[model samples]
Target: MADKKNRYNIRDHAATYWENSPKWRRVSMSIAFIAFFYALPFLNNPLVNTPGSDFQSVLFYPVGMYVLMAIGLNIVVGKSGLLDLGYVAFFAIGAYTMAILGTHTALNFWEILPIGIALSMVAGVLLGTPTLRLRGDYLAIVTLGFGEIVRIVAVNIEAIGGPRGIAGIPTPPDLFKAKFTILDPKPYYWVLLTFTLLVIWMVRRMAARRPGRAWDAIRQDDDVAQLMGVNTLKYKVWAFVLGAAVAGAGGVLYASQILSIVPDQFNLNVSILILACVVFGGIGNLWGVILGAALLAFTPERIRFLSQPRILVFGIALVVMMNLRPDGILPKKKREHFDPNWKSVEESGEGEIK
Candidate 1:
């Protein structure tokens, strides 16, 4: 085993620019992010401003949504050390719940958010309660199947538009005189960005507390965690539930922005892609995930002139990375004895082995 002092180092190892950023600079950067998309439409970027072009907005909105999904999934796959291949199931549940309720009834976007989130949380519990006991690849396979099952159900359900999908999801209410129309995507972008920020804040805050420690403990070794009096099952379930809530929120944003959704959108590939962001960004590292999500989401579009396969390229990148930097561009780190519960060997009366 590695030395207990060095096992989980959460120290900052960011590039000089980021590591050296002062508090004022950090705050300024955040403000820029909040206004990034909302100001894009006014900018004279031909790629997006050119008439009949919705490409840029479309590309960015989905990226924002997926970023949220990646954040949520990181809680399970990275923090809790649980491999969840069926996370898109929650995404689908949230999207469909909102789509059905918002379209059929008079429910506005704000009104539908809670219901969609609740449904997704319920779905998470339904899956987690029965499967949290499974470990390793077994849990992964079950999750993969769960995602498929949700999509299959969506395909057959006529009330939710079957294979055709639900459409004409009402746009969110207006802000003063401005509205979130299809052409004016700035408002929609801001909404997604705000949600993404909130999820990031919440996840970071949680990671500083007992819940975060419990998650890391379970991730390191469930047996040892249980021995330390951590209720492994409960914490594991909470991980799924919280992750599901985030994914559900993503779904709500996505469905509202696109104004429609089909069963095909939330598939296993989506789950794999989000997981890739987590792994590529270095699992268990929050900032790493954010950087990875942005890079992976945007690079393909930037390289479109090459006309290469995105997934194929992604697969190759993963292969190369595994052979080189498996810890990722920014691997997770933690303080020595950050959590009081994880005592040093010397403290536990187990001296160093010679």
Candidate 2:
């Protein structure tokens, strides 16, 4: 009976099969999956490509960028249980950094990349230090305000082009004789893919180590974690800083690809969309979050024929999804099981307490 039950449990069976597989086989399968994504642009499948838009460009912007941002935001909202509504601020900081330096200075993309990330990290630290103490809705509100503040500041500062935004942002240097131009978005897609993979690798490693454990503890119960000497504040700050750094890198890539950026581009809606991706995908589950981001990002472009009503359709779909799976499409798996009270069972005459 137990064997039959175990065999019929698809999730358990699949998990066990993957776990028991040879390391080499697992590595090969992962490589193949990644290779498939890398070849996606070349596939040119009518079903996968958007009807009215450039498939590669769409992949680079909403698809690639959204996936990257979702992963970052997942660390905060999903792992650390932090509600950050101002996540777009870090993204804007990174984008503006690249735009300002790329236009005003002789620094190349590679050089300015670190500067953008560093500044974003600094911003994270500044915002997180005092604000990390607040929990739940309070933190979210502060972050939301922070995001708006950044945008408003950008609009008022005419030196940074204000509402007009900065233009002529130089693209990355030619890589292996392939020029990074607007006409061909494949190179940009490839670059973004490489960074996305790198971020995934790093995040996975972090999730498996002490920091990941710390986040899990914090997420489960911040008060208990602090009582257990987990230094919740430090971990919370770390999560914020790391998430900001990822956003910053994404901003740099975005600016280089578009060659122009406006304050409006990094608005509150961007943060909300990224948050929705994280929520719709599966919160702390890494692959679930990635899948969610890609699907949500691609859906609008795919259904452009619906025109203005497409948004209504999208909203309806989200509502349906939430109703069906409130936890998310690929919610994080839980290992804990409920243990029934033997005394209650005895009183109910359901079973004997052996």
Among all candidates shown, the one with the greatest TM-score: 2
Per-residue lDDT of model 2, residues 1-354, tens digit only: 122223233334556789999999999999999998788888788788898888989999899999999999998988888889999999999999999999999999989999999999999999999999886678899999999999999999999999999999999999999799978888888888898899899889999999999998887667768899999999999999999999999999899989999999989989998988998987787877998899999999999888899888888988898887665777665442233452343356421111
Model 1 error, position 122 (Å): 0.7
TM-score of each: 0.84, 0.92
lDDT of each: 0.79, 0.87
Candidate 2 Cα lDDT to native: 0.87
RMSD of each: 5.8, 6.1
> Going through the candidates in order, what is the number of backbone clashes in each?
5, 0
For candidate 2, give the lDDT of residue 321: 87
How much lDDT does candidate 1 score?
0.79
Off by over 4 Å in 2: 1-14, 336-354
